[model samples]
Target: APLGISNRDFLQQRKVIFDFPTKGVTYMHFKSIEHPEKPLVKGIVRAETIISGYIIEQIQDDPPITQLTVISQNDIKGLIPKYLVNLASGKAPKQWIGNLINGC
Candidate 1:
């Protein structure tokens, strides 16, 4: 992250690990660890939660297709509403996939 740990919005993630479990498959894992501080906030208080997830990318060679699958749990721990998280989470993967496709 360009802003390092103190990002403007949320705390920048510390690490991302990439693994190749098979010949044509790649797995990316990310998780929010136990930070020494409570979550930061701008207007509303943000709480750190157990945000863990993995994304899988599998490439098929016959017709040349890339399959992407993302699974995550991002339940915030403060007074933040569930609906807000749901909305943001729903939109994030689509944007990622779109960007990846466009880049390729």
Candidate 2:
């Protein structure tokens, strides 16, 4: 008679584990959850551009995030990451200015 295998045994056999880095995913396009009527958000890649005289402000590139492109409708099960979703939703990002004089 053959013995039954446990969940752990199955996992071990499959070599599955929750050991992966989830940080520094800088570039990624996310779909919109707020407005279904609108199109999917496009992720923008930031680049340096010299304007006027000084380097300031960032702009979105034409190409969307490569990682996001792989994601299918089914992959986006629920509300996706806010940053990524912003592209499609046309949402504004949080802004904060520091006061050098006051040290804010």
Top-TM-score structure, candidate number: 1
Cand. 2 TM to true fold: 0.14
In order, how many clashes per candidate?
Answer: 0, 2
Model 2 alpha-carbon drift over 4 Å, by segment: 1-23, 27-29, 34-69, 74-104
TM-score of candidate 1 on Cα atoms, chains taken together: 0.55
User: Which window of 10 residues has the lowest lDDT sum in candidate 2?
Assistant: 5-14
lDDT tens string, model 2, 22-46?
3323323222233345433444222
Which regions in candidate 1 have their CA more than 4 angstroms from the true location?
A: 1-19, 34-51, 101-104
lDDT of 2: 0.26
Q: CA lDDT of 15 in candidate 2?
A: 19
